[model samples]
Structure formats: structure tokens, C-alpha cells
Target chain A: MKKIINKPEDYLKEMLEGIYIAHSDQVTCVNNDLQCYVTKTKKEGKVGIATGGGSGHLPLFLGYVGDGMLDGCSVGDVFQSPSADQMLAITKEIDSGAGVLYIYGNYNGDIFNFDMASEMADFEEGIRVETVLGADDVASAGPSEPGEKSTRRGVAGIFFVYKCAGAAADQMLDLDNVKRIAQKAADNVRTMGVALTPCIVPRVGKAGFSIGEDEMEIGMGIHGESGIRRGKIEPADQIVDEMLTQIIEDLPYNKNDEVAVLVNGLGATPLDEQYIVVRRINQKLETAGITAVKYYVGEYATALEMAGFSISLLKLDDELKELIKHPVNTPFFKQ
Target chain B: MKKIINKPEDYLKEMLEGIYIAHSDQVTCVNNDLQCYVTKTKKEGKVGIATGGGSGHLPLFLGYVGDGMLDGCSVGDVFQSPSADQMLAITKEIDSGAGVLYIYGNYNGDIFNFDMASEMADFEEGIRVETVLGADDVASAGPSEPGEKSTRRGVAGIFFVYKCAGAAADQMLDLDNVKRIAQKAADNVRTMGVALTPCIVPRVGKAGFSIGEDEMEIGMGIHGESGIRRGKIEPADQIVDEMLTQIIEDLPYNKNDEVAVLVNGLGATPLDEQYIVVRRINQKLETAGITAVKYYVGEYATALEMAGFSISLLKLDDELKELIKHPVNTPFFKQ
Candidate 1:
């Protein structure tokens, strides 16, 4: 694994400095550390939006922070959640008079740490905090059956939640409203991903998992969690159908129900393959009598260079539609 | 080499259908073929913006088209430029009474085909066409010497040109002014890239190039062009030094000059490594006494899972700064 770095230890610091230099106008590093980039403008009445997660997913946490998206982002080490202290500091820094909203993915460490930070903000800092955890990946646990609690895992679909929440904030919605809208978006969303290969974490120095050249793991987690099933690499149409079937069945979207569809390539899948998946997914949606109101087919969220994709569907209504359509200005997503 | 596709040939069409469904409110596929997604409400007086390149590089061309960025994008095969006829159809369909501006990366096929389409548009449809070729990869081509032509290649730095040009178009600038702003943005930019590993095109189903696990290629092209030199993967600081030294010397930006910087991950490099690269790049910029006015670090333009990264600099002026800062609403870039 040849890489460009002074020492593996210095990787995080160097990267933060570069991000700050690039987005200096819209953001600045807090405490001169690359852990957080807070927006420059502090609107008195706007709810401060803060997002955080692992490092590899760019334009998700950092790039999405700007005028119309996240107010700040707490970046952790690769695939690790930021410390509660770090999230606390960022929350304080970006907090306006109104309140602060925490939008993050539903990972174990993230949930635990962010919850602690939220409590600290309320009791110690006198700041109100609201959170909306994005748990769109359907393969995280399983269906919510009698014994299955459906352990929620956050994946690329968090980007959509950020967009919607940011739009709500941009519209001067309060923290409660923002959290509600974000949660609504999250609840209506379900995603399932497949992986052809595993990614090598810089620290790990080897692939997180192993997949044979002829096989793929379906419902793989971004952090390389064991997926629901493994099978031979099949045609794109079959692969997409399997992924979308799980998502559609889980969400139980019905005829005339509008939805936003996202077919995301997990880093390594060529756009050509992703597009092919999207085409098949579209045909499936039409056949199922579902109306895809909005569709995004690209690498919105990725798992390093894992050569596969995921399908995300966000069931939409009038309000969700308006929120999804709301204007946003961020480095990664704009609409 | 596992992949998900029933037929490689139908990849583009399927992906375009999915994209159109997701963004139907803001974009739609022209001719029902999903080759081009034109804006739904292009103002009649504004210069129509059209961008297209290969498929894998997401948000680069497709995600950038919306309310304020591009009018439409004609997606080609992965890493391959769209055909001349496709370009011509996109130009013709997206024309909003005003002239159309074709903005794209400076690849050989893209240049030739887009040029042909522009000529056809002018001669056949009288839809006065102009073009701005993004040539920001400083390592690929040097500045033109006295009477000598530059072979500059466009890479991730094209995003800056897109923002600036899109802003100009949003302001309803005429075709000439739009072209001038775009060219100015392009002229002020420079980039250099290094690859840790080569990418594999889906159609080809092989690595674009071969590199040892312990080696890296410096000054590599987006499409795997031979780099200036290859060497063992060095430390992040040293790599940044090498990349920035050449770029700074080539552009010779003054101490007082302000610029926008982009530390772009070429597909496979994780965010951890990207941030490490960004850190060293910023430190070097500060050491050189250059003021980085703005910075973006992420996978803006990519080469399908190529394990590499690039650095881009756009020396900023008041006009360029304003344009860069202008509000942009697209699926990929919002600010």
C-alpha cells in the first residue's frame, strides 16, 4: 500500500490543514486543529447545524458545511467518531442564540459520544441540542421482527438528511422543526449496499475484509461490517434488483407513493456500472408502480475503493418534496 | 474484478434514467435516451451551460447542473468523451434562445468532438456556440512559452472554472462575457497529481496502468497518462513539497497573491490520506508566504478508483473571488 504521507501519525493533521486552506472563506479550523471546520458567519437566529463522522467520506461532513448546509463538522480519525469533548467544543463554537442541531450517522461510538455531548451542552453550557440519527442502511441489523431490533447503521444516505435539515435551517426553522424534518427524512429512507472488495484503512494497512474476485457481499457496512448475504458477482440488473427489493420491501412503498432514489457507487464501481444499476432500478420502480420523484445516481457516499453500490429510497410527500427541493449551498451537495 | 452489470453496453442509458428520475424537478433526460439531462427552467436570457466528460467522475459534470451551475450535462462512457452527435444534441436541446457555452475538461477526444459540435451548432442551427476548455493540470502541460503551445490537461481544477462560469451565466452575462470569465478562471489555475495505484475502466476491465505496491506515479493524467516521473511513495510532507514546488514555480504566485486551492482525491485515496495531503500542502503554501483565500479538499473530479490525489490553485482576483463565492445550487455543488 504505497501512500503519500510523512508518517501515518501525521496524516490527519496534514489533511486538516489542506481542507482549511481550500475552504478558508466558508470555514475555519477550530483551535487550529483540523478536527472541525466551523462556518464563518454566525446568524443570530439560525439553528447551528453540526455533523461529524469518519474521515474518508468527504463532502459529507466537511464539504457539506457552508451557507446552506452544515454550520460545522467534527472530523474524527478514519472510520472513528469524534470524541464527545470535540463535539462539545464544536457545538459551543457554532451555537447561535437560538440553539444547535446535531445531524450525524447512527454508529455506536457516534451515538454514545454525541449523546454525551448533547447532555453536556444542556447542563454545562446551557445550550439546547437536538439530534437526528441517519440509519438508512437496511442491512445493518435485519427486519424489525420479534427478535430482531433492526440495528440501524448509517451510510451514505446521511447526506440526504443533511441536505434536508440544512434547507429547513436555511428557511429559519427552529431546532425542533429541523430535527423533525431530518428524522422524517431519515425514517422514510432505507438503503442496502454491496461490495466487490474491501478497502484498506491507512492505519490498518490492509483490506478490512476479503472478497473473492468472483463474488460480492451484499448489505456490507461502510466500515466493512459483515453483510446479510454473499454471492457470485451477477449482472448489474440482478444486483440492483436484489438491493432495491430489500429497500423497497423494508419501506413498503406503494403505488402513487413518490420517492427519491439514490444509486450510489461504493467508491470503485465505475459510473458506467452505477448508471446501469440506476437504469435497472428505474425500470423496477416503474414496474412496481412507484413514482420516483427525484433520483441521484453517483458516488454520493462511498466506501473507499469498494467496487459495488447501494440503493437508497426516501419516500416523499408534499413537505419532504419541498424540503428536498429547497436550495442548499455546500461543497458536495447543492440544490 | 467482480462487477454488477448485465451488459456493459447499456450502462450509460440506465444510469441516466435513474439520475433523471431523482432530479426530475430540476433536470430531465432529453430524447428519452438519458444521454443528456437538461435543466427544467433555463432562463431564456441566460447563457446555456453544458458540461460532459466520462461517467465515473460524479458531481463533476452531472451533479453540477441545476439552478445556478450548468444547464445540462451530456454523460459519456466512463473516462471516454461523448460523441460529437451527443454533444450537438445536448447543445441544441438546452439552448434557451440565448447562445450556449460548452464547458468541459481538455481531453483530446472531448476537445475534438465538442469543437465539431460547436461548429455544427453555428452552421446548422445558428445557435452561436463558444467553449472554455479547463486546462488546470499544470503537471500535465506547462505554460505556453513564447510562440509555443501548452499541452495543459484539465483535472479537478475544472470545478473552479465551473463555479466562476456558472456564476457569470447566472448573472445573465452574454456569451462573450461568460467565455471571458471562464477563460480567466482557467488561466489563473494550476494543478499537479500523483497516483498511488492505477484505475480500472469497466469497459476495459483492467488497470489503467501498473504500479508496484511500494511505488507512486507523479504528474499522472486523469485518464492514466504517463506521469513526469515515478518513484517510491514518499512521506506526505515530501510529496506535497514536490507537487507544490513545481506548481508554485510554474505559476510563481506572489506573496501577496490570494488563491483558491483544491486538494482533490483521485478516486481511491481515502479522506484520511487526502487530509494528510491537504495539511502538508497548506503548510508549504504558508511557508512560501502565499495567501490561500479559499480551499476545497475532496474528490471533485476523479479517475475511477485510481489511488491518487491532485492539488489545484486558482489565483484569485476580486472578480474571480466574487464569482467563486456566488451562490450556486446544484446536486453536487451548492455554495
Candidate 2:
């Protein structure tokens, strides 16, 4: 593969090392540690927020750790789960007398590891751990009442879950209050993405799936899951229309409900394309009478060199609105 | 081209529309205009800051417009310059009776267009425009006396010049004061980059130059200027060591001088790789007895889908340090 890397196996280690050196002000490796990293300047006395998952998704787990963001993150290898030890260690490092909140996307390995870590923390130390799983991918499961809470693959909508929960934590809300807001953010959020090109994993030189130059897959997962539909490439407006149509109808978003829209580029897609998608999303929301009062269009979450984008809508109430609008400063996210 | 775009030629227009829609809270189009976009949330009574150049490099021109950044940006087509008319119009719009400070990368087309705009503004509108040309790319020209203020391509170091100047303007500094600080930032900064792969321009749909799968070019320009050397792709630390060796000696960055380090990804390179490079950079700086106080590693400046990274260092004095540390919030940059 034509990558700017020395070795495929060393990719994860090198990446974490880079994050440590590059963002020393916002984060630090736990005791020169790469597996677990915590925010250097976290808000004190708040319910410490933590999130983590497999590597390769830049800024997802580790990037959101600073002022008004996560307190710590436990990172795994590419597409592999971090050990329970790693998670427990980071959890202990970030716990500030007020318990810890582990908010992550609902993936099998992640669920197992985080659960194990929480149990380990409870047994080894008397630290309380509250969990809020991200299950916002609309294509992962059929929507039942209150929306399918389980088995739904969490995707880019984790951005909202982390942000709202982190904001609440920044405000020194208790563990219960932070968990409540985080769950609300998850329930109110829905996301779907389309991929124009396949991403090449560093270890594997070939793509997971072959895609034609003139086609795209709608509802593509960050892990490059076979999407719901594949068809010829469409204009920005058409793509946004189809994706938003599904997301809006799935939630049955009310005519005048408020939302914060995230147009996230999956790695190699340019910011220009993201904005075009956002422009169309704005028009669609207007037509649907949904007030998109806040918009974040950029590379919030990314798959390695994947050429596509995911549009995530977090239907907002007044509390979520205040949390979303709260000032945040981190290496990857600043608002 | 395997891009999620409607037409290659329409990229710039669509991007501006996206930015206008996404950042409505911070910026507005020049009355439904794509060529000129101005900040809606600029600090009044401050010297209005403006920067513009060719499109393709996101967040450089338009993304840096808001409360603590540029007041306006005159956009161009992909890899092409914006017209003098656009610059003059934005210059007029961002003028807050404190005159306008024009800060941009030192590219030929940008220099010509901005010079023409300033001339037109003087003759036609009687607006005083002071410009701080960004010439921080060390490889662009030989380092002569007084730091070769002219004949250097701006590259990523322009981020600091705009940032410090914008911060000074936010402090309500007069036009001359802002210009002075911006110039200081430009002179104190230097950058060098290497490209592992070439960028595919949308208009062309083909790369300008191609490197061997295992080969890399050191000191390559953002526009793909040929570098000082090319060889097998080495490990991240080795590459950073060589790059910093050149940069440190160029300015002869003293033992105790404070500076800011920016590791900029040229579009398609992964953040993980960028961090690995930063790790080596920190090691080298410490060995050289230089103090790196602030670190920014991400895609601050990017070429279209190019897999490479640039390292920029800004030698900071007390005034420049204060300006850089000043709080500023924009759609793309917050510090």
C-alpha cells in the first residue's frame, strides 16, 4: 500500500505517540503511556467523562479530551478492543471523587471491554462507573418504539453523545444528570453515511470492497460495512435529500423541532464537499420545517482515507441545546 | 476522479455555499456571493483582518473568519486566484473605520490580486490597507539577510501570521500595530514539507507529479514544488529529524527561545502519521535545547488528497506570544 508509514503493525503505536506529543497541552499519556491518555486540563470536581474504542477513527475516543470534553480515553488496536486493564487504568486516572462516565459507540468488542473495565474498577477500587452507549446508526437495525436502543451500530452520532455529556460534566452535573443528558443526546441522534471510495487498511493493501468510480454506497459504516444501497453517484443535494429523508422520517422529527446537524467527512473527503452537503441539508431541514439552529460540518470522525461523509442530526431540546452551545476546547473539537 | 462532487469546476462555488450555510453564526456571504465572504461576528473598533488566496486549501482563507480571526476572505477557484474585484469588495466590507489589514500567503497570483485590490481601494474608496505578506516557507527561497522577507511561498506558517494578527486586532490594536505584529510573525516563522504522494487537482483530475511508492520528497511545496531531495520513505522520526535539522539551523533558533510547533497534514495523510512525526520533532527540539511551548498538529493547511505533512515553527517573543495566546473563536480555528 502507498502509505506514509514505516510498518503496518507499528501504525497504532506511532499514531498514539504523535497524539501525545502534538497535544501535550490538552492531553497527556498516562505515565508515558500510549494505551490510555487523559486530558491535561480537565474540569475539576465534575463527573469525569471517558470514551474509547478501536483505533483508526481519529479524534473519536482520544481527540475529545480537554476543556468541556472527555476526561480520558482508552484506545485499542486498529479495529480491535482495548484490554480491560487499559480501560480500568484510564478510568482510575480520570476519576475525580465523583465517579466516571463511559460513553462510547455500541460495538460488541467495545461493550465487552468497557463492561469488563467497569467491573474491574468496582472490584479493585470503589469507583462508580456510569455507562451510556451510542446506538445511533439508523441502518444497523429496524426502528422500534423509542427507537431501537440495542444492536444499532453507533457511527458519527457519537460526536453529539460525547459533546452533550462532556458539556454536562463540565457544568459539574452529577453522574446521574450527566448520564441522563448523554442518553437523551443518544436517543435524539441519528446518522447515516455514504462512501464514494473504499479505505485501505494499513495492514491490508487491498480494499474491503470494490467500488466503481461513478458509484457510492449509502449508509456505509465507518468500518466499511456493506451499505444498505449502492447506486450511481448523485449530486450533493440529491444525496443529502435521500440521507436526510431516512434520518428525519426514522425519528419522525417534528416540524418545528430544533437540531444540531453534523456533516462529517470520513477521512479523505475534502471540507468543500462537506459544506455542499451541509448547504443541501439546510435546505432540506427548512423544507421539512425542522429548525437546524446549530451546524457543524467538518471531519468530526473519520475512517482512514475513506472518501465519504456521514450526516448526523441530534434533535435538540432546551437542555441539549444549552449543552451543545457550551464552549468546548480540545485538540480536535473546539466550539 | 473518484470524488463525491458534482463537477470538478464547481468545487469552489459549492464549498463557499457550504461554509456560508455551516457558519451562518460567524460569517455571511457578500449578498449571495461566492467570491467574497465576510465574518458576521467580527469585533468592532478593531482593525479588520482579511486573508484570501486560491481555493483547495480549506480553513486557510475562509475558515479563519470570526471573532478572533480574519474579518473577511476573498475566495478563488480551485488552485486559482480570486479576482481583484472580489478582494476590493471584501476589503470594503471588513473595513471597520480602523482601516483593513490584508494578510495572505506570498503567492504570485495572490500578491498581484491583493496589491491591485489595495490600489483600487485607495483610489476608488480611500481605504488604507496594510498588508503582511506570509513568506515562511524556507525551501521556497534561499535564506538571505533579514530572513529573505520576499520570494517565499507561505504554506502552513500563514496560520500563525493570521492568528497573531487577528488576536492583536481583537485586542483593538490599530492597523499599524496589527501589521507590525503580523510581519513579526511572518519573519520569525519557517516551514518545510515532504510529499509521499501527489494531489489530484479537481480541474485536472490527474496528479502534477508522482513519487515512487517507496520514495518521498523532502521540502516539497503545497502546490507540489519539487523538493531539495528524494529518497526511500524512512521512519517518521528520521524524516522529522532531517526536516527539523534544516529548519532549526535556518533560523538558528536559539537555545532558550520559545516557539510554537505546527505539524500540518497535507490533506490525505492520516492524523496518526502526523502525530508520529510530532513525537520525533519533540525529541529533536529537546536535544537542540529549544523550548516548544505550544503544539498544533492537524490539517491546518492541506493540498487536495496529498499524502504528506509539513512542519512549521514560529519563534515567539513576548508580544507575539501574548497575541497568539489571546482567545479567539472562529468556525475553523479556536485558541
Candidate 3:
């Protein structure tokens, strides 16, 4: 309720307008609609990668649209999915001679909308569009059933996917290679989160959920997707251990396996605390003989003003490593 | 109060450990103290730019240490000044024949500690460390006298000073020019914030202050410093108009003045809301015929999880413009 927003209904529209103004040099509003903001960094004969999702998660979908990153982003209302029309418009806007790739979090709404966009782009406009779904949230679905992997929601690990895919695209890779790299990035990533408090949806003027003072929801998805376990909040070490254990084991990262670690905040958590969690994660990785080659810590993806954090591990190979290391100059995911 | 910290007492120590671990490639802890993280990006005979302050402000003190940016930074406990020892050690470590420049926000603790470090660095290490105190927070103090400008507290606008000063330092400007540019940046900048909710200090486990559900404090400082006025929380446009009016007029910014605007989140406010604030800010400037040459939004400086934002305008010149657009890469800040 204590938000600096205008009309709740205009939240998405106004937010994108602001972003376009702030980053006008790097991006432009596509189709005169605020939902789709395409980057001015797009190059001819390069694969155009796009990602979009609900609003409120700053730097999530829109933050990656820039140099060495996504080409366009279709935004939705806070925690809601963008319309297929918006996505299709962005696909057309970003598509060069090369094809377009849709990379996004694994959510029902996003899947439906992006799928529709893909079909419409291909059938209606004869544009080639491929999809790479991200379902890295380990707690949303278990690894015990491989078939259910797609049921998992995406979290902070999507950033890893975006980086690799974006970098690959930036390297002027072919469309097939870009999709392959994106899928590999998606498959190699895993994430788990803890929510200290629920975020209030601006329109709702109330939190999506409530918790006791000392309680936290472990493995909560970005949009308050039901977490697996809720219990009394523990210390930083305990929380990091519990969350990272699942993420590492779920990915089955083993000895001598190199990876990138991202300790991301879920809105209100301070970067200092995220770094604390990353410190523990690095120690844990060292003890396990799993080398964490690169580390990113901060609010990469958020759930409104929720006070929690997520640990994402991307099992890395030389290709993924090189791709991630490629300089990215986006407003959010800068290298 | 909810937070993702292990122990309030260990917050600073743990946070620094995390930072060292996260950015080990680009930075290193100086003198075995986690508080003083110096960048590996320092070049021989280049004026070192060092800034530091309380721990809670993300990317304020520590985040700017990287290539083409700050050469060193010393961090303090949450909302507390770092010890003079930490500052002195960094001054020594980053000094590469060229003198060092100390650019930091104007807080009492920071001023006292940094001044001590400056004196010690001069006496013990024979290093030249000129100071440019950032007192751009327009609301913290009034212009009581001609020389009372130093009485104002620095807020998010300090980032502009850092970017410009760091860029100048990276250009290998001599100590005097670097200091002059830093002072120019400080003098040209002004910031005013509105606070919706106060943040809780970890040790205290309580908010610094409280506000009614429907109330907001305009001109509030990042650390809950008393603002100019309190009133019912208004619409986004209303708040932006009120805050921007004071900031623009205080600077007495003219119709033809070209400026850079930063609509920064205090901590917990969503990016969408910050954008909304920025949109209004940009519009207001345009309406006044003042050109906002550039815009920077997001949480440049935060007060823990305080739900508010500040608007900062830096009267820009050709020198400042070129310096700001200079390429710099750091973990938290990049352009």
C-alpha cells in the first residue's frame, strides 16, 4: 500500500515508460506499446534473443535487453504474463535476417503467451522463432521425476541462461547454436530460495502471503509460488546450507565440477546479506571439491518487497564459461 | 523485523567476506582487513579515487571499486563510519605514486573518520589525499550560511559524483584536476527523498522511525534524518512534483540548464515504482524546458529495506558529461 506508484492498473505502462526514458540510448519502446521494449543494440545477421515476464521483478525480463544480452523484452503486469500480441510485436521488431529466440521462465502464463507468439510469428509473419524454457527452480518440482522437470518455475538461475544465450547470440552464433546454447544453459542451472516475508502486489494493497515473525518459506518461487517447506527462520549459515544443499544435489554437481554461483536477493534483502550467503556457498563448494568459477550476488530477480534470497548454481563447461565471461553491458546484468 | 542476516554484530564482517569472495578477481582486501577492499584496476601513476561509508548502502561505498572507477574503498559497519585504520590502509595500498582523492557522502561519522584517515595518510605515508565531501542531500540541511554547504548529508546523488570523479581519475588527471572535477560534481548535484517506511537497523531489530500507513515524509535522508515536512502519502505525480520542485528550485536550475536525473530507490521500493517516479521527473524537467541529458534510476543508495526513493539532479557540463559517459566496469555499477 505504501508504494510510489500511480494507478495500480497503469503500473506496467508507467514503469516501462520510465525505463525507456532512463535507458533510451540502449532501448526503445516497440510498436508504441510499453509492453515490448526492444534493444537498439541488435545487429544484422545475429540471433535475436528475447525474454519477458511479469513486472515488479526489477532486472528480470527487461534488465537484460542490451549489449551482449537479449534483443527485446515483453513486459507484463506485475507478476502477470504479457499478451501474445506484445510478444509477437517484439519478435518482429527484433528479428533481423537471423531468427528470434524466446527465452523465459517456466510459468504457465509465460509458456502460453510465448508459445502463441512463436506460432503467430512463424505462421503469420513467416518468422523463425524458437523457445527455450527455464525451469531452474529446484523446489518447485523434484528431480526424482524427470518428466516433471518442466513443472518447476524459474528463479534467479534464469539469469545464467540469459547470460550464456545472450553471449552466444552476441558472438553472432547461428540460430540453431543459439537455441542449443540456451537450452544447455537452462538444463545446467538450478536454484532454490527462502522468503522471509511476502511481497505486496501494488494493486492488491496486501501481501500475497503472511508468515510469523521468525518464520521463512524455503524454496519459495519469485511470485510466491508455494514453497515446499515453511519453518522458523534460522541463521545465515543454516539457511544457506539448507538451500544450497538442495540446489547442488538437485543439479548433482560433483567433485571437480566447475560452476557459477549466483546468490540473488528476493527484493528487500540487502546485497551485503546476499554476499554473506555467497561466502557460505563458496565455502560449501570448496569443501565439496566443486569449483565455483564465477560468482554473482545481488537482487537479480525479486518478488516485490519480499525479504529473502535465492542461490543459483549453473554447472559450467568451457563453452558456457566462455559465453558467460563474454562482456555484457546491460543495465542490470553487467560484466 | 525481518532480515536475511546471521548476526547483527557480525553483519559488517560477514558482508565484507562475501564481497571479497564475490569480486575476488577485480578486488582484493588490503592489509588483511576485509573492510578495505582495493581494486586490481589501479594503474601506476593514476590518481586513486577512494570512497567509503556505512555498510547498509549497497553499491555506495564498495560497489564502485573497479576499472575506470574507484581504485579503493573502505567499508564501515551498518550506518556507521569505517575506522580510520581501514581508510588509511586503503589509501596506502591504492597509492601508486599519484595522489589519492577521497570522495564520500557527508555524514558526521564519515567526515570525522575520513578526515582522520586523510591526516594519517599524509603524515604516516606521505600520500596526498584531497577530500571532496558530498553534501548533495538538499533536505537534510538548509543553506544557513555561505560556507554551510558542507552541512548537508550526501544521498543517492553521491553516485554521480563517484562516476564522474572515478572517470576523471581514470583519465589520469592530475590530483588537482581530479579534485576539482570531484568538487564540481559535488557542488552541481542536489537530491531530495521521500520516505514511506523506515528501515530497521539489524542490531536494534527496530525501525529508525515510524510513519502512519497513509503518511510519507518528504526530504527524508537515507539514514532517517528528519525531512522538511510530513503529510499524507500522495499520488506518484504529486510526490514527484513536490520533491522535484524543492530540488530544482534549491539549485535554482534554470530553463536552459542541462542536467542528469537519478530517481533512486531507498531500498524496498520496486523498480516499477522508481520508473514511475522517473517518468514524472523527466516530464517535469521537460515542462520546465530543462533538458535531462541522461537518466539513472534504481537503488543506487539504499537504507536497508526502507520503502522510499530520492530524486537527484546533477547540473551537467561538457566535462562532466564526457566523464560520466566514460566506460567503467564494476560489479554493481557499469556504463
Docking outcome class, model 3: medium
Give the root-mean-square deviation of each candidate in angstroms.
3.7, 2.4, 1.7
Interface C-alpha root-mean-square deviation, candidates in order: 2.7, 1.7, 1.1
Q: Please report, as a residue range, the 10-residue window in candidate 1 chain A with the lowest summed lDDT.
A: A141-150
Residues B218-322 of candidate 3 have per-residue lDDT tens digits of: 988888989999999899999999989888888766778899888888888877788898889889889999998888878789988888999999998899989
What digit string (tens of lDDT, one per residue) describes model 1 on residues B1-335?
46666656666666666566555667777777576667787687789989888787765778788777788788788777888888889899888778999888888888889999999999999999988888888777755687564588888888888889989999999989999999999888888999888876667877877888799888999889988999888887788898899888877577878888888877767665676776677777788888777667666887767878889888899999888878766655556
Report the number of the highest-TM-score candidate. Answer: 3
- Scored by Cα lDDT, where does model 1 land? 0.80
Evaluation by TM-score, superior candidate among 1 and 2: 2
Please compute and give the TM-score of the first chain of candidate 1 against the native first chain: 0.95
Q: Which stretches of candidate 2 lie above 4 Å from their native place? A: A41-45, A142-149, A204-206, B42-44, B142-149
Per residue, candidate 3 scores C-alpha lDDT tens digits across A1-335 of: 77888888888778888888888887888868878888887589999998999888988888988899899999888888999999999999999979899999888898999999999999999899999998898897754555544678888898999999999988899999999999999999998999998988888888888889989999888888889999998889989999888877786656899999888878878777788887788888899999988888777888888889998889999999899899887766678
Cα error of candidate 3 at position A255, Å: 0.6
Interface RMSD of 1: 2.7
Candidate 3 residue B26 Cα shift, in angstroms, is: 0.8
Comparing only chain B with the true structure, the TM-scores of all models are: 0.95, 0.97, 0.97
Give the whole-model CA lDDT for all candidates, comma-separated: 0.80, 0.85, 0.87
Alpha carbon RMSD to native, model 3: 1.7
Better of 1 and 2 by lDDT: 2
Candidate 2 at B282: error in angstroms? 0.8
